[model samples]
Target: MQISSNEIAWRGGKVVLVLPLPGVKQTPPDSPQLQALYAKLEGARSGGAAVAPRLPAADYHQCPRGTSVRWYCFYQNRDWNENVAGRRLQWSDPHCDEVMDFEVYSFAGQTSSWVNTGFLEVTVWDDSVHRLWTEAPNSLSAYVGSSNNDQARFFEACA
Candidate 1:
């Protein structure tokens, strides 16, 4: 999906990762509601939802090396001690000297009062190759599958 610089900076988020994908091409969401209004919000089903931009194969392939592919959702709590279900991978690059960094977002970037307590599942994708840090879910993790994506370890404040 293509977006203007203004749109990206304002609403595209700090890290805009792909959820349902082929690492190149992703299938469309089944539900129109899920594809349209509901998924585009900030929270999960409550108030925060995010739209997984449908990028064409050609465009996806041409993406820059430093592009950030992010997935975000509402974390329904402030205090966290238990580990949630997730996957850990160390995304790497073979050609470039950069190591793709991944993070299970905390509440540090939620500066707006209008938006709910959201957590970002962020990771940097290089053009060459990628790697994983861990293999299973815990307090901080994320899965890398088309249907099993967005398995992060966070909660919303409303919980």
Candidate 2:
């Protein structure tokens, strides 16, 4: 999908990373994937129930030195824990360093809020490499996942 900077209307997210896809050709706005992505965003913008897009399953790839790709979703809870979910896809250089870092943070970057609670699922897709990490006081423990690609890691806040 070819979404120039101006086309993206952020509703709540503070930062959205848009990276150049090396080999993947840009798809017209009407393409299925692009359409789904747009609709998903529009639903969220309009405060309607948004459905998660069917993204390509992630598979660990042997990236060349210095190239990597990473995909992740972060959830933060304040008072009572509720079921929340976030998903995204990213493209990275096929041949780069492969590093996956795990860092945890509280909801909305607020460190003094309630204790970290609820479950967060992290899924890495494609062959690119990336890093993830949480901050101190936020207890995040990986629950599952055999490999980086398509692994489901559930992190529950420490009591």
Candidate 3:
């Protein structure tokens, strides 16, 4: 996949890191964390649901380092209106009480790097309220000396 700043910020860096919501896949269930996210999305599907359409997974790639690369995740609501709530919605909305969660595991070498050294930024717009949250970077040093090209190729092949 082509690596673009806009795509990286909006999509989860790549498809490999993005997992589908529950009942949408035919493999083992997602992790507990993902399961919770699926629940929130399911709850947001009501007919009168004030909540917007929730996006499960979108990945993007960032080559912040000349040699190393970083992956980011994006979660957004589809039904979110830009002009609602009189332009004053709280962070916690009674109509839309669901919060989307995302996670990424970092690796250094081909093995499970087991290192966490990346962060995620979540942006939400409810027409009345706009909110942003920045998560701390997971500090995994496994990919420290890895080649960015190799990673890019892997993502491309996976795509």
The most accurate candidate by lDDT is 2
lDDT of 1 by residue, 16-97 (tens): 3222223323322223432342235323323334644443343222111121222222221211111321111111112123
Lowest lDDT 10-residue stretch of candidate 2: 60-69
lDDT of 3 by residue, 21-40 (tens): 34432222224443343334
For every model shown, what is its TM-score relative to the native structure?
Answer: 0.18, 0.19, 0.20
Identify the candidate with maximal TM-score: 3
Better of 1 and 2 by lDDT: 2
lDDT values, one for every candidate: 0.25, 0.26, 0.23
Candidate 3: minimum summed lDDT over ten consecutive residues — where?
Answer: 85-94
Error of 1 at 24 (Å): 26
Clashes of each: 26, 18, 20
**Residue 34 of model 3, lDDT score:** 32
Q: List runs of model 1 lying over 4 Å from the truth.
A: 1-29, 38-54, 58-159
Cα deviation at 132, candidate 2, in Å, is 9.7
In candidate 2, what are the lDDT values of residues 58-92, reduced to their tens digit?
32111101111122323222111122212222221
* lDDT sort, best first: 2, 1, 3
lDDT of 1: 0.25
lDDT of 3 at 158: 11
